[model samples]
Target: MSTTPDPTYHRPVMLAECLAALQLRPDGRYVDVTFGGGGHSAAILEQLGPDGHLYAFDQDADAEQQAQQLIRGPRGDRFTFIRANFSQLHDELGRRGALGLDGLLADLGVSSHQFDTPERGFSTRFDGPLDMRMNSEHGPSAADVVAQYSEAELHRIFGMYGEVTNARTLARTLAQARNARTIHTIADLKQAIQSCVPRGKENKYLAQVFQALRLEVNEEMEVLQALLTQSAQVLRPGGRLVVMSYHSLEDRLVKNYIGQGKFFGEAEKDLFGNVQRPFESVTRKPVTATEAELAQNNRARSAKLRVAERSSLMLS
Candidate 1:
């Protein structure tokens, strides 16, 4: 296994852009909800003074290990690493007596470390165990989802989460194949649904299938909703919310929540006709990677960054 301190463990996407979006205050408290390789956490710590505090959260044990390395380093005193999903943001902050943050940053989706590591099973490039849980120690793995979910359930996940075409057919195929042979590995899954994949779109097809399973196994959409809802309560007035999402599903949720303070439906209005919202969007449109950043890191290609600020009005 590679050492956690290695910089290449996971190269953070859009580092400068994220920092600029936060508009950090040297003495303010901040949170990095997805401290994958501690890259963003470390950067946030750099801008902080001795009085400032930075809380980092991640459910993955590997991430926790990387966080420990950061904690033991020179500026460790300024950092607090929480080993929990960002969905538990509110409770975790309350437990630590660290509510009302000045800024909160969430770099959503699977980290490069998770993708590059074959055993983690997050990448389509490698053939490994179909286990895509961010926190490998808990929850059902991708294999469990593929092996257990009904055809209907599978179809729903593939269609809604992965946006897979012919999701029903793919789900039925998996259901039949699993009964004949267990779908435990990445290779097994690909072979099981080989016939369903489009002639020239095998990679894309497999990605959709894997994405659906990963999302279901990790409850990503629900978790993202929880985080966005809690962030409204946790951030101080004018506090920043910076989120970088790789996929449209995650980006849409962030965009909608930031714009209207709710994921589904339009914003509710007061009797006076003023819209009541928790956070006002800072970036009118989602920001994407620059050509320069894209050249250096191909992963940045799909990233969409959105920023918002806590509203001062404090709606009931």
Candidate 2:
């Protein structure tokens, strides 16, 4: 068997844009919650002075292993990697006496390495086990989701998360197919759902199906909500919340939370009708990749970066 080292990571989406969005401080405290391959974390460290510190969080063992390489660097002492989900941001940072963050950065979505690796199963192009958990060791695998979820539950995730056009049909198809045999691998899933795919839209439809399964298997939407909620409480006044998301669902949540301080509703109004919110929106609109950047990295095409700042006055 070949023992090739996996590539370090894909070029970070919107590298310059993300850096600018953070508005770095020489003595500030920062967090890179999605330290995939440590691209952005390394860059942030480069900008920090001796007093500045960075704490990164990732649950993936591969990512935690990769993080070790940074600890041996010249500025290693200034960095810390918490091998847990960013949803634990509050307690983890508090434990280290690292609260009152100056800025927080989250590059949300599966890392390129995870998607490209066949066994991880985030992509539809591979014929690997249907395991899509971000942590890999914990939670139910995508196979478990497919095999155990009732048709209605599968339908809910497919329609709500994937926005698959034929979500109902796809869910019913999987429900019936798995009844005959286990949909245990990527090939098994594709073959089982072949009849439900549209003729010329095979790739797009499968992508949606895979996306829905991945999101549900990982409980991504819930995790993101937890992270956003905790970020507001942790950031100090004027602290930055820089987030880059790949899909409409993630972006919508980020946009809403920053703009309204709540996930689904308007900001609450005080007695004087002053809108009370956690973070103030920095980007009037979501920032997308430039034509120049897009030419260099095709994956940057779907990226949407949104920056926000903790309100000057703390909210209850």
* Predicted model with the maximum TM-score: 1
Which residue ranges in model 1 land beyond 4 Å of their true spot? 1-4
Clashes of each: 0, 0
Clashes of 2: 0
Q: CA shift at 299, candidate 2, in angstroms? A: 1.1
lDDT tens digits, residues 1-316, model 2? 2121234565788989999999998899999999988888988998898999999999999998778877877788889999999999999999999989999999999998898899998888889999998999999999999999999999999999999988999899999999899888999999999999999999988988888998998889999999999998789999999999999999999998988778896777889988778888899999999999999888899999999999886656
The TM-score that candidate 1 achieves is: 0.97
Model 1 agreement with the true structure over 139-233: per-residue lDDT tens digits: 89999998888999999999999999899999999999999999888899889999999999888888888888889999999999999999988
Query: Where is the poorest 10-residue window by lDDT in model 2?
Result: 1-10
